[model samples]
Each structure stands twice: as structure tokens, then as C-alpha cells.
Target: MSSFHIYGHRGSSGTHPENTLLSFQAAHKAGAQGIELDVQLTKDLVPVVIHDERLERTTNGIGFVKDFLYEDLVRLDAGHSFSSRFQGNSIPSLKSVLEWITSNSLMLNIELKNGRFPYDHLETKVLELLTHYHLYDRTIISSFNHYSIQRLTQNGCKVETAILLMEKLVEPWDYLQQVGANSIHIECGAIDEYFITNTHKRGIPVRAFTVNDPYQIAALKKAGCSAIFTDFPLVAMQSI
Candidate 1:
């Protein structure tokens, strides 16, 4: 398709409370075909949807997320900004997100938040959760951690995997192919026509992240990006 598919990066974060159920619903309302979110493991190793390592920025809780168990993390108010609009909204589990995605027929980009502490079973757990929700085909699991993506790919999981990056490389597609990834999504600041065309020539889809600028978003489109991730889904729809 010539029109690039739009995804709500953390669920239309510009309009609604970010990473909250309300945000996902708002993203859907904004005509986003896909929803992208980050996943981190709690102390109990329960996969919870969040971005940062600490809860202080988005929630009422203090301290690193590694210090808290899944039970405690989910109890904290995740809808701090839109408290009135989404009272009692808490950090959701992968299972919950999977259910929501499947129920709404939304494509999903599942980004694995990398961290220390001997992360085991993270790839398996994510695959299992997606399988439990019957979303193997509709979801794309992505990460900057190459090993994590390799693990998921080796497990015979049917989901697509994308390599995420920030910096520019001389041969971007060759670099990604070395890691066995067929898709690459880079930060908007680092994307260029050469990078896009090189990646497309390798039979890999190129996407740009967090692009909100109308002119820059148009540039990414002209560069042959298969999709674009943005916090303002409505603005993206308007542009694309």
C-alpha cells in the first residue's frame, strides 16, 4: 500500500493518558490500525506494560520497577494525568493487552523493554501470552536487544520481529540481516532515504518511530516506510 499504516505509539499518548486503557481506546477512535507498547517484567517476572524503569514518572509509585512485584505495580494509578477521564486505571498485564488487541482487531507492536537481572523466559513468556490470546499472526515483537529477538525467532513463534535502532549505520539492511530481522524501525531523527531504500531492497519493511512533524512524517513516507509510529494518531491520519 502507498499509504503507510499508522500505529499509536503507547496508545495515542498525545491525546489521552499514555499506556492506559483509555489511551488504547482513544487510539482506536483516532483511526490507528495498530497499537505499540513496551513490556517490562516485574520482580515476580510478570510481564506488565510500561516504558520507563521507574514508576515515578507515570504513576504515584516511587523506586525502580524491578523492586516491585506484579501485584504491587498493577495497583498503582497509571492514569495520573487523566485521572478523571480514567479513574482507577492501572498498569495492565500482557494478557490484558492481548485481550484488548484481539477484541478490537488491532495490529500490535510488542516492544520488549530490556533490563538487567538475568532475564529468563521473557521471550517465551511473551510468545505464550500472545499465543494464549491467539495473536501470533497479528502482532510484531520488536527489541533493540538482538539476543531477545533471536530467541523469539528461534522458538518457532509465528509473530513478526523488528529490529529497533537509534543511530545510523553505513549498511543498515546488511546489519539487520546479520541478526535475522526482516523489519527495522528507527528513531525519526536517524532515518534517511538511503537507510530506507537500502532496507527495502533487502525485503525488509522500514518504519520510523515517534514522528509527529508533518513535513518530516511526509519525508519518511517518501523514503518508502511501510509504516510510521506516532503518539498523535489523529495527526498522523491527517497527514498520511
Candidate 2:
């Protein structure tokens, strides 16, 4: 296997329902070194592994995820929308994912989805869970909401934190230093050899997101990216 990390974006989402345990297991079977997943608090303040603030996109449930309690959220079919083969797969809690992860050596990148609805104590809650599971050393916390990332650093969080970006910046490393972030997780197109090389010169790692094309994957790897988040881990692994 290549030294470059290939994290299954939402756990092999290209082949399975995103964020479900089934998807996670598939990523593992495909030899992914890590998995990147989204985290948001349920109505009950229980953190769950999902990508959206609303349920309509990935789940059978209606309305916002904040309106449903964890118990109610789990009862809904999380995978049926993807395919009939995944008819019974329910939304996995952060706790459940942590428990499952104990059985494997996969590293985790947990993206705090607080940009839409800022969940109360989301940073502390996720930190507590990581503490309980003894996963702080193996996890990387990232967020589009730089405030949450700042909160993690200000509170002296032990886990590595990365800033998620959608656009190119003149000097992203300066922004990273300002936010006290450990690394960068950016849109794939926004990164190139110069960007990756310059960022690495500052001793910062850059990981691109949602990169699925084999050509792009090879290019990023050649550019010396620390990692690439892809929906097809097997294809990425093969490309490298």
C-alpha cells in the first residue's frame, strides 16, 4: 500500500449509503487507512454520525435532524433511500461508531457539522466521547465553522484539528496559524502542486476532499498531499 492516506469519504459512499455502518465496513474491507465522517447532535444532544442538518437527503425521516430525538432518529431507515439491499440500516450514533471502531485500527476524521445549526456544547460532547473511547490520539477533528475549531484549540483539545475550506486562499497557512489548527482539509480543485508544496514547506499537511476521479487522485498523490478523501477508497488505493 502507498504511504499516502486514503480516507473513505463518508465511508465508501460511492458504493453504499453514506455514513451508515454498512458503508464504514465496506471502506475497511477495501483497505482504507482512515474514514472521514460528519458529526451532529441529535435533538437529545446525543452526537450521531451523519452529514446533513436535515434528514431528507440521506434518511427516510422528514424535517431537521435537531427536531428528532436519538431514539426516534435511529428508528428511521438510514439506508433504504440508497438501495433495497440496505433496507434495514439505521443511523449510527457517534457512540456506536466509536464502539465499532474499537474492533479495527482505522483512523477517524470527524467533521463537526455545526455551520448550519450550532449545537450546544458540541465540541465538549464530542471530546467527551473521544475521551471515553480513548480515541483522541487516533482522531482528527475538523470543521467548516472555524469558531468550533477555535473552541477546540482554546479549550486545549488534545486531538488534531483541521480547517475545512472551499476556496483557495492567498496564504492559508497564515489562517491556519491564526486559528491554531493543525492542518487543512480543502476542496480538491483548490489544491495544486504549488499549494501542497508551499503548505508543506510550513510543516502543514493538506488533505483534499471528495476527490473521486482516478486522474485527480494520481495528480494529488504526485503533488505530495498528506491525504485524499474519496468516495471510492478501492479505486484510490489502486490508482496510487
The candidate maximizing lDDT is: 2
Candidate 1 to native Cα RMSD, angstroms:
1.7
Candidate 2 residue lDDT tens string, 36-86: 999998888999998988899888899988889999999999998999888
Q: After superposition, which runs of candidate 1 have C-alpha atoms over 4 Å from their true positions?
A: 1-3, 81-87, 115-118
Each model's lDDT comes to: 0.82, 0.92
lDDT of 2: 0.92
Clashing pairs in 1: none
Candidate 1 C-alpha lDDT tens digits along 1-240: 355888999998987778777788889999998999988888898888888888887888898877898988988988864556665789888888887777788899999888454357678788878878888788898988887877666766578998898889778777776777768888888976677666777678887898888787777787788889999998988886
* Model 1 CA lDDT for position 235: 92
The alpha-carbon deviation from the true structure for residue 73 of candidate 2, after best TM-score superposition, in angstroms, is: 0.5
Alpha-carbon RMSD to native, per candidate: 1.7, 1.4
